[model samples]
Target: MTIQIIVLATNEKADAVIKQGSLAQMPSLQDGWRFDFRKQLKALKHATAYILVREDSPEVIEGCLIFQLVDKMVPYMAFVEVAPHNKGDEKKHDHVAGCLIAYAFKQSLIRGSGRL
Candidate 1:
């Protein structure tokens, strides 16, 4: 299935991300880094959330990422994860992580940060 990326800007969308089937399935603590998505997501002032949806099914989220616009010029991606089914060699989709990074780059440019 094709993937569509969108910036989450509403409570409805936020709720969807929280209720997604893979939400609880994802690691509560990031490996090697120890960041908490649940806690981090709550602090919206520090980061923006972006999600990837399966084109054929809006309810099916392929991935999600947390990024911050720092100094009003730098956009930093703090956390990212693909749906469990989309990880590893038998992954359901390709470049899910790359898509999020690209979106982050787009945000940086939009904020007048120029080329990264």
Candidate 2:
């Protein structure tokens, strides 16, 4: 499912999308990402992954999210990372982390129905 999100472009708020990510589209450290996302995905076997990309440039990922339900109850956010361009003061986008976090919370409400 596509979720609406916002990104920064020339200091303006632009539309983006958050959706389920597949192994084929996974990013790696070599791709200018801080973490080796492929390795993280391998290590977090039970987690579900998601990616944030610009609406006009789906090919350029802005961030990634890895999450899962802990013991089938509590929602646990295992990992989250934004592209190098989305980090620090020179960041190209805004709300990259917030959008991923909000997505996790939404998942918790939808899929994590059990109590911890």
Candidate 3:
């Protein structure tokens, strides 16, 4: 299975941060914090999942979520948001994000579920 992730930026600032390809890279939120998108794929490549990003602002992370489709048919999803000023929040955000993505996919399979 092949999954595609498209990064969306409102302006040049966010645009500049993104690199091209199946493994597009971007800088982390904190100064000097960087990670390669390739590494993320290496971790998830075995799974039947893909990511599509819509970057509005760092604030969007507060409302970001993930969705997944299995065998191009069954859909599952979940909802998630970030908690401000918490050390463990990042992990929580990731978990919720994954769930939200699955939720969105599942909802898409239903009739008249509307946009996620």
Candidate 4:
């Protein structure tokens, strides 16, 4: 399965991600999960969001990440999750979160943060 990682851009796209995230199940997020894309949209001064999706089927999101540029221009991972079908032992995909983190590192480089 070919997956493509992208930066979340619009509220319309964020809505789609919010829908998928609501259906996603991650152990790390089980305690009290909440991905406030609305808040992200409202406050993107130094933040960005990322998502991974099936290349051929854009609607099928595999993972997501939200991060911000903090002091010293560091990329601070704020929120992250993988789709329900792509979590745990019966996962449909692998290393999606890793890919997101790698992407964040790349962004940090692009933004002149040196390294992530």
On TM-score, the leading prediction is: 2
TM-score to true structure, per model: 0.61, 0.86, 0.28, 0.58
- What would the per-residue lDDT of candidate 1 be over residues 3-112, giving only the tens digit for each residue? 34433332122212222223343334543224455667666454666667654465665667777776665778778777666665665565667776777676666664
- Show where candidate 4 strays beyond 4 Å: 1-34, 40-45, 112-116
Candidate 3, 1-116: lDDT as tens digits: 11222222321222111112233332233512233223333454222222323344322222232233334444433222322321152321223333335445544675223343
Model 2 agreement with the true structure over 1-116: per-residue lDDT tens digits:
45554444555676788898997788997888877777888777467889999888999988898887766677889889888888887778878888899899898888886666
43 Cα displacement, candidate 4 (Å): 5.1
Sorted by lDDT (best first), the order is 2, 1, 4, 3
Model 2 poorest ten-residue lDDT run: 1-10
Question: lDDT tens string, model 4, 4-104?
Answer: 34333321222122222222322233432355454553465566666666555666657777667776487676667676776656665565677777766
What would the C-alpha RMSD of candidate 2 be, to one decimal place? Answer: 2.0
What does candidate 3 score on TM? 0.28
lDDT of 1 at 16: 23
Off by over 4 Å in 3: 1-60, 78-107, 110-116
Model 1 lowest lDDT segment of ten: 10-19
Minimum summed lDDT over a 10-residue window in model 4 is located at 11-20
